[model samples]
Target: MSRRGWVLFLAMSVIWGIPYLLIKVAVDEVSPETLVFLRCLIGAALLLPWTIARGQLRPVLRHWKALLLFTVLEMAGPWFLIAYAEQTLSSSLTGLLVAGVPFVAALAALLLGEEERLTPVRLLGMAIGVVGIGVLLGLDVDGAQLLPLLAIGLVLVGYATGPLVVTRALPDVPGTAASSIALFVTAVVYTPFALPQLDGTGQVSAPAWWSLAALGVLCTAIGLALFFALIREVGPQRALVITFVNPAVAVLLGVWLLGEPFTLGIALGLPLVLVGCVLATRRSPARTEPSELADVDSAVP
Candidate 1:
């Protein structure tokens, strides 16, 4: 990676990672629907102009259906799920749980007839990831928390599947434009549920407001730009390595700023899941498939 790539890479590492903590704070005050809606509204407001200026929306409209699917899978569904899960789950645990996305993404690609062969090492990686999941769940989750964990399960499926949809179905769409359109569509879809609650949002705390602002501007709008820049600078494979790095940042921020614990489950399980991600996704993707990697990269808390 070049110096520019390193700069973008480092920016996105914290940019993407801190959202889990942000969601944890903001969701404590607002409904998940409202947070998702307001965050998308802010991000779309910032990014839509760029997409239009670049004439990216014309090609995006040609594949609106796929774009809508990407929106739902990547933003509308999973973002809300992550916010909802964070209400009960610790930020560190939530980030750690999501580290399993690569495992699911690998399976998604194979089932979708992607060209990359699933070697034995990848299978072993998945097995190790599953064990890590067991350790995390066995130590941290209680029966009462099962529903939130299940929400995280849906989030995993959405985050994993969204990329495949964008890759195969929206091949011509630029990453920034696709993401901007998705955010716009998500904001529109959630308007009814989110709008009615805006009257009460004035009561939300200062930190929550700051968290929401950072989420909208830094994590969603500018974050996409930085990610596309990273991909352009360093190529998608090196860009993808940031996923392995994000959960650590999330865990550290949660533990330090929010005073969330570095539980034994996280200490043990996070390494296993991240290693699994590395091993599972080590095989080179078909060159074409990863070009819009922001599809996977952008779908986070």
Candidate 2:
């Protein structure tokens, strides 16, 4: 990677990482659905105009079925679940749990008929990743609620399924148009829900509003553009490596800024999961990275 690639890489690392903290702040006062709606709405408003001006937006509609599926799996489901789970789980712990995205994504690829060259190291890596999950749940903090953890489990599956839809099902759709459609359709779907609460006193906090703005403008909208740029600069495979760094940034922000604890579980599980991800995904001919957006968007919250 060149100097510019390093800049994009570092920028994306922080850009994708901080969403966990931002979501934590926004959801403190706002409902999860409203947060998702506002975030996606801002992203679509910023991105769609360019796609339309360039006449690339219309072609994406032809793949609307797959596009819709990708939206539901990637943004709709995972984003909401992350918001909801952040209500209970520490931003740091939530980010750590998401590090296991590769475990589910590997399965999604094989199940979706991607011919990945699965090897012994990959299987062992998957095993180590699972054990790391157990460790995170076991050692770090005991009193965390089970329901939120289960919600995150669903989020993992949804996030894992999204990339396959983008990589295989919607191959003809350009990245920007595909992402614009995803955001726009999602915003439209949640319009009935988010519209009613826009003026609610529940979401009037200054930090909450600023967090929402950053999530939309910096994380979701601008982050997508940079991600594609990173892909162009370094190539898609290398761009995806940012996934490994995002959790660390999430954990650091959660601890340093949010005053969340750095528990033993995080201390122990973080490396195990990351190493497992590297071993599981390295040289595999499949898109199993946690931040598997097919060069279209940031990894996650």
List the global CA lDDT of all models. Answer: 0.86, 0.83
**Candidate 1 whole-model C-alpha lDDT, 0 to 1:** 0.86
- Candidate 1 residue lDDT tens string, 122-197: 8888888888888999998899888899999999899888888867787557888988998999999999999899
TM-score of decoy 2: 0.93
Model number with the top TM-score: 1
Considering only N, C-alpha and C atoms within 3 Å, which residue pairs clash in candidate 2?
none
Model 1: how far residue 282 lies from native, Å: 0.8
* C-alpha root-mean-square deviation, each candidate: 1.7, 2.7
Which whole-number lDDT from 0 to 100 does residue 217 have in model 2? 95
**What is the per-residue lDDT of model 2 for residues 1-301, given as tens digits with 9 covering 90 to 100?**
8999999999999999999999998888998989999999999999999899999877878877888899898888889889999998899899888888878888777777764657899899989988888999998656657889999999888877777777777765667677888899989998898888887945378999899999999998899888877877887778868888998999999999999988888888988888887777666555544333453322455
Best by lDDT: 1
Report the lDDT of model 2 for residue 270: 89
